[model samples]
Target chain A: MKNRVVITGMGAVTPLGNSVAETWEGICRGKSGIGRLTKFDCTAHETRIAGELKDFDPLRFVNKKELRRLDDFIIYALAAAEMALADAGLASGAAEGERTGVIIGSAIGGLATIEKEKEAIFLGGPRKMSAFTIPAVLANLASGHVSIRFGAKGPIGCSVTACSSGACAIGDAVRLIAEGHADCMIAGGVEAAVTPLCVAGFNAMRALSKRNEEPEKASRPFDRDRDGFVIGEGCGIVILEALPRALDRGTRICGEIAGYGNTSDAFHMAAPPPGHEGAVRCMQAALRDAGMEAAGIDYINAHGTSTPLNDAYETEAIKTVFGEHTRRLAVSSTKSMTGHLLGAAGGIETIFCMKAIDTGMLPPTINLDHPDPTCDLDYVPHQARKAAIRTAMSNTFGFGGVNAVLIVKKFEE
Target chain B: MTLEEKVISIIMEQLDVTREECVAEASFIDDLGADSLDLVELIMEMEETFDVQIADNELEKIRTIKDVFEFLKSRGTVWQE
Candidate 1:
């Protein structure tokens, strides 16, 4: 049998709030974090609203001089990692270099930094660019910064699978622990893509909600009036420890990472297959990995991005996976509350799912006033509900037909 | 664009502060809370603003707000130091 893995702690820096408690409160209250893009002026763009991180005083986590060397995503990663480590009750110097590792992923690395540098190059001569420009914006720098900060000298790397990056990173960490590659891993996703170029690109694709007038109501997942996803930024991380290691250390375990499944649709670049066959397989594979039947799942954190195709296809996938039980399952799209966090969606939604299982309360899918007939499901629409949740699954699908499903169950301690 | 105005605008934007925060005597690292990267960005902005090339050797000695002004003056850009 493979070694078991359990989530010892969790951390999140979401548009809803800076800390996990604050984020959870926002989720439970069915708050909308999407708002006018204040990171930069988006007045010229069609998509003006996004889930931007607010009041992010980086001075709380990083030194003044050190802040200049890192990108916003890296700064968010370090803050979340620090919060996770503390929540896990592990001191920075407690773990040996070989025993700990970091695997944070991002969809677009440091787009904001790149945009700034590009503007500099166009306006200034070659000598104007900073020496640290390349390293600051690289996709793998998030993992590197976290590892160096915590001295986690074990396997340190990143995954860049569009929006499924976080799920892939967490799944990789699970495999590492199961295969005896490491004892503990800091794994999740971080993204800070609230920049002019990023917003303009998504706008050009018509993939973002143009409901700039009503920012909070812009992201209406599964609703008939749903338009497009609201791009968001933040980092969500969890401390994954081998079961035996966690037990030996007498740590307070939160949940078990029972299953991880990944697949590619090979169908389209940005849209799911006509029948969502790949999504069905992804969920089925996760169930197989967890050694659990379909009926065992008590709740599902759907990848409802509020787009026309994704919400409809995801509902079809759920029906295919659970059949009759699909209607009975307490399904919700926290994206309705936090908006679409893109790369960080998987990690943060996994955290929410785990907490739902642990606390026995399903978070609501806010603004589901008028649901689409094709997207009909429990959806825990409009209000939070108390339920007996034993096992929960979080689903994440991304552009380029990438899909990842994680089965996180209540810790049996 | 006037080089001084151009440079000051970039500094204000990058630091996310106002002109009051960047008094002429303000050091990039000390008063503006600019780390190494911020300084680099400032230099990059200066280079773009003046259409001048600042070598590493020239960049190494720049410390205070006055230093940046004086260096631009020496380059024949002739701004108030």
Candidate 2:
């Protein structure tokens, strides 16, 4: 009998908006956050547009001294964690310390810091580097700083599994609770890699969308005219506590993490295999873990990266797993609005799932003007819909062929 | 600004402290709450701002703002104050 893990709180800072409330509001209203890329001058690059965050003030979350030493990714992680702890009523020492943990994941942590320090070394030799450069650029330092901020002493780690990093962090947090290692965990993913080098590297590999003329119409997942994913930056986090502990504290339970699946295609570095067999098995594994049938799921928040390959193959993967029940699944790709947040996608999309289960409203896959011939699922398109959904699944597939599926459902006694 | 004012501004910005607390007699670590890393960053910033290099051994005597002022004076930093 594994311990039941319940989500007590959630937080997010996305291209759509800075807070969970704002981002979800943007999603519910079917607003697109994709815009012109201004982080760097991409005058010669093939892809220029991106999903950039707006008005994100890091000073509100960290002190000036610490901010000078910290990178944007770590700052975003800390901000999301602070919001999550406050939402969980643990910020003021309500329920924290030894039994709590933090695990933040990022596909590429501190890319801007790395780029800056490299320039420093070039301009004034290695002696010009700041003393805190190493800590600022380390991939695991996000979780390290988050743990220090909240004094969570039990288990501390970070996941770096490309785009699946955030989902893996949350899933591993669930494992820790079920294994009796922690009563609570602050888990999620963050990314702030929208720098010159990162964008150029992705463009060199032909990974990002080139729809610079009309940014809002760019990230059209499942549409026949879909391009590549628009790289975005943000963080998403949630507080997961054991059901008994949550009940004892009388906290408002958002949802229950019923099942999780982690798999890999092992075929490509950046592309999925022929039929998305890995995704199929991954969803099956989640269902098995939840003791659920295919018909039990009422909604699916698809990974839907808006890349030509991902949207169509993901559609096939859904059909393979759910079969006839795919017709009944209210599937939507909030990435249509939020863009592809990479490692942070899982954390944000998981919150979208919980919000769906709580509000009985399914977010839409915006800008799906022309449906692909291969993509035939009913993707709650263009407009948000109200549905009494009980169970929701979120799929996140990352580079290096990693796939993670999480099943969330409304809480029941 | 004078050399003394330039060095004090660098210290203030690097240490993230108030202007009033950065008196000449105040200790960098004990008074301004600077750790070893903060001292290193402060030295780097000062060196960059003044366009001069201070040897590592001279760091031992730089415990207070007065010591920094004297060190800069001894290194031929023109004291306009």
Write candidate 2's Cα lDDT for A49-166 as tens digits. 8888898888899878988999999999999999988898888865458999988999998889999999999999989999989999998999999888778888988999998999
| Collision pairs in model 2 | none
Worst 10 residues of 2 chain B by lDDT: B72-81
What TM-score does candidate 1 reach? 0.87
Tens digit of per-residue lDDT, candidate 1, span A1-413: 78999999898999999999899888888888888888887778889888989898898988764577689999999999989899999865775479799999899998888988888789965665776789889999999988888899898889898889999999999999999999999999999998898888888888888888999998899999999999999999999999999999998999899999999999989989977989999999999999999999999999999998999999998999999888788889999878887788888998999888877789999989999999889899888888988899999999999999999998886
10 residues in a row with least lDDT, candidate 2 chain A = A88-97
Weakest 10 consecutive residues of candidate 1 chain B by summed lDDT:
B1-10
Q: Reference contacts recovered by each candidate, as fractions?
A: 0.33, 0.75
Candidate 1 stretches greater than 4 Å from native: B1-81
